[model samples]
Target: MTAPRVDYDRIRDVGPDRAASEWLLRCGARVRYCGQQKWTQDYNNLPTGPLDRYKIQAIDATDSCIMSLGLAHMEGLEHVEKITLSKCHYIEDSCLKRLSQLEKLQKSLLEMEIIACGNVTDTGILALQHFRNLRYLFLSDLPGIKDKENLAHLLKVALPSLELKLNLK
Candidate 1:
C-alpha cells in the first residue's frame, strides 16, 4: 500500500522495505518498480515540484492494463534529469507523448531503457526523439526497430550526444 502523501526521507532512512512514493517528491529520487505492483498511476499524483532523477526498471512490468492519469501531472517537474523505463510490457509509443510536455528535460536527460515492449514499435521508439538532452539509451528486444539506420532516423536531431543500443528480437 502506498500513501498519497508520504515522507520520503523518513522512509529512505528506514530503507526501501519501508519506502513510500512521497520520497520521490522530497529529494529527486530514483525508483525502479520491478515487483508485482505497478507505479504507473502514481505518476499522476506526483507533487508540482522539480524531480531529481528517476528510473523505473519495470522490466516484466506485468500489469497488463492501461494506467494513464493524464499527462497533466508531469507539468511540475522542472529538475528531472533522467528517466529509465525498461521492459514495461504495457507502455506503448503513445505514452512518450506525455514526455514531450516535459520541456525542462530537453538537454540533460541521461538514460531511457525500453526493452521488450509489446505495444511499442518503430513509431513508438521514434517518439523518444523529443528528449533532446538524452545521452544514453537502451532499446533491446523491441519487435519493430531494425538497425542503426532506422535508429538514426528516429532520433534525427536534438540530442546530438545520444547513444542507442537496440535489438530486433
Candidate 2:
C-alpha cells in the first residue's frame, strides 16, 4: 500500500510566520483588535529587536483582542509615542506593569491613553512611572482607581515635565 502524499507547498501555504510578521509590520502607529486570532501559534517572547525598532505611535485595543496586549507588552513596544487602550477590560493588571521595562529604551519619550478599561486603576497608571521618558498621559473610564495624588507623585518622581490629561467626564 502507498503512503498518503505530503505536499510541501500546501504546508507552506499556511504561512503562519508570514501572516503574523506581516500583520505586525503593516500596522503602523497603532494596532487595533476587535476579535481574537489564534495568535499563540506564532507569539514568541524571544528577543527579536525588530518589534521594538518601530515607532508604533499608538495602539487602540478594544473588545476580544485586548488579551493580546500581554504579547505586545512583552515585545517592548513602549518606544511608541502614544498608546490608546479602550474596552480591554479583560487585560490583567500585569499587562500595565509590563510597561516598566520601557525605561530601558535608549530614548523613551512616550505616553499612553487608557479608556474604558474598568480593571485598570490609578495604581496601574502610577506604576507607569518607570517609563521616565513619558511626558503626556490620559486616563478615563476606569472605575477601580480612586485617587490621582499617587498618579501625580509618579509624574513628579519620574517625569517632572509630564503633562497628564485625565477625563473622568
Candidate 3:
C-alpha cells in the first residue's frame, strides 16, 4: 500500500492539531488531546466540536507506518509534550531531523521514546538537541546506532538536564 498522504487543505480547514490527529489516526497511531484522558485511535470516530478546540498532547505511533513526509503534520502543533515511536518501519533519521526543526515542538516537547526502529541511528538521536525543553528520552533496539556511549555523553553535554535511558547492545 502507498504511504498515507497529508491533506494540506484539511490542515487549513480544521487547524493543525486536528488535521495531524486525523493523519496519525489514519496511519494507526493513537493521539491524546490536551485535557483528554483516553487516546483517540479511530479515524472515523474522531471527536466533534470546534475545529480548533482540541490540542494534541501526545502521540503513540507504535508499529505505525508514519514516515518522514508525514511528520509535516506535526509542524504546527504547539502543545505536544510526548511522543513514542516503536517499530515504525518508515521512520528514519530524516524524520527525526524534520521533527527537530519544528519550532513549536521545540519548546513544548518534554519526553520521547524511540524503540525498535531499525532506521534510526546516532545521527537521528543527535537531532533531538533542538528540543530545548525536552527532559526525558528513551532509546532501545536500534541496531543502526554504533556509538552508544559517545552518543549518550554527547546528549548529556548538549542537554544537561535530560534523563536518558538506553538499552542498545
Query: How many clashes show up per model?
Result: 4, 1, 0
Candidate ranking (TM-score, best to worst): 3, 2, 1
**Evaluation by lDDT, superior candidate among 2 and 3:** 3
Residues 121-155 of candidate 1: C-alpha lDDT, one tens digit per residue: 77766767777777777777777565557666557
TM-score for all models, in order of appearance: 0.56, 0.59, 0.96
Total backbone clashes of candidate 3, pairs 3 or more residues apart or in separate chains: 0
- 81-128: candidate 2 lDDT, tens digit per residue: 555677776655666776555444314437677778878776677667
Candidate 1 lDDT for residue 6: 38
Model-by-model lDDT, in order? 0.51, 0.53, 0.94
Candidate 3 lDDT over residue span 1-169, tens digit each: 9956778888988899988998899789999999999999999889999988899999999989888888888889999999999999988999999999999999999999999999998999999999999999999999999999999999999999999999999
Better of 1 and 3 by lDDT: 3
State residue 32's C-alpha deviation in candidate 3, in Å.
0.4
Best by lDDT: 3
Q: Ten consecutive residues with minimal summed lDDT in candidate 1?
A: 58-67
For model 3, the stretches where C-alpha displacement exceeds 4 angstroms are 1-5
Clashing pairs for model 1 are: 8-23, 28-52, 106-133, 107-133
